[model samples]
Target: MAAEKKTAIPKDIVALSFEQALAELEAIVARLEGGQVDLEESIGIYERGALLKAHCEAKLQAAQTKVDRIVVGADGGLKTESAEIG
Candidate 1:
């Protein structure tokens, strides 16, 4: 028999790109809210959802430190600086 793929833990999910993590989180939420999963499955889904949420939050927190820079005045050049977007 083929081995079943294991779902990632929350920490592993945090390593994924924002888009990838968000997509997985959305899917988990849909499954939980769909009302079709059994109690056991629902519990598992809820766990996964929590992990995804944590991963997404960590990702956002890490991204908050990024910054961008711009230069102006006579030369009208560009500069590098910390980005200030959340």
Candidate 2:
């Protein structure tokens, strides 16, 4: 069996809000696409960008889970359900 691969997230990255992480990721992409960074720097930023992307995905998934759980009942009361959300 293959062990799951997990990147070690930097402490600073863990503290960043979703927006901050995304902005940094965008900048990394721009640098890579512009071909301004040297090979070493490009590799470094690409790794960071991967971490940022994963962080953003985790944040969005948490938000989606919360949103999916809440529903307004027929009686106009708010409740949570595990059922599939349309």
Candidate 3:
């Protein structure tokens, strides 16, 4: 079972929702930090964590693109500007 888990690839990792990916990533971090796994398993989980981190970052970037900032215009009216959140 452990060998199968190491060999399995999360093909849907990229398709996972932001919350789902984040939760899985957090779990991986906790498991890795627990110091119970050997080096090989640690490397496998670390790779998965990297993918999860990328997915979360992409989700955040996509959400940021849709975010708009409200600013006061010269005519004393509210205007919207594309806000970039890094």
Which candidate number has the best TM-score? 2
Model 1 lDDT tens row, 1-86 = 01112344545775788789889889988888898999998988777777776667667877534457665647777667665675
Residue 24 accuracy (lDDT) in model 2: 98
Model 2: per-residue lDDT, tens digit, 1-86?
A: 01112876778988999999999999999999999899999998988888888878788877644444778999999987777657
Per-model root-mean-square deviation over C-alphas: 8.2, 6.1, 8.9
User: Of 1 and 2, which scores higher on lDDT?
Assistant: 2
lDDT of 3 at 59: 78
For candidate 3, what is the lDDT?
Answer: 0.82
TM per model?
A: 0.59, 0.67, 0.61
Clashing pairs in 3: none
Off by over 4 Å in 3: 1-10, 64-86
Ten-residue stretch with the least lDDT total in model 1: 1-10
CA lDDT, every prediction? 0.71, 0.83, 0.82
Shift of residue 14 alpha carbon in model 2, Å: 0.9
Better of 2 and 3 by TM-score: 2
Write the candidate numbers in order of decreasing lDDT.
Answer: 2, 3, 1
Clashes of 1: 5
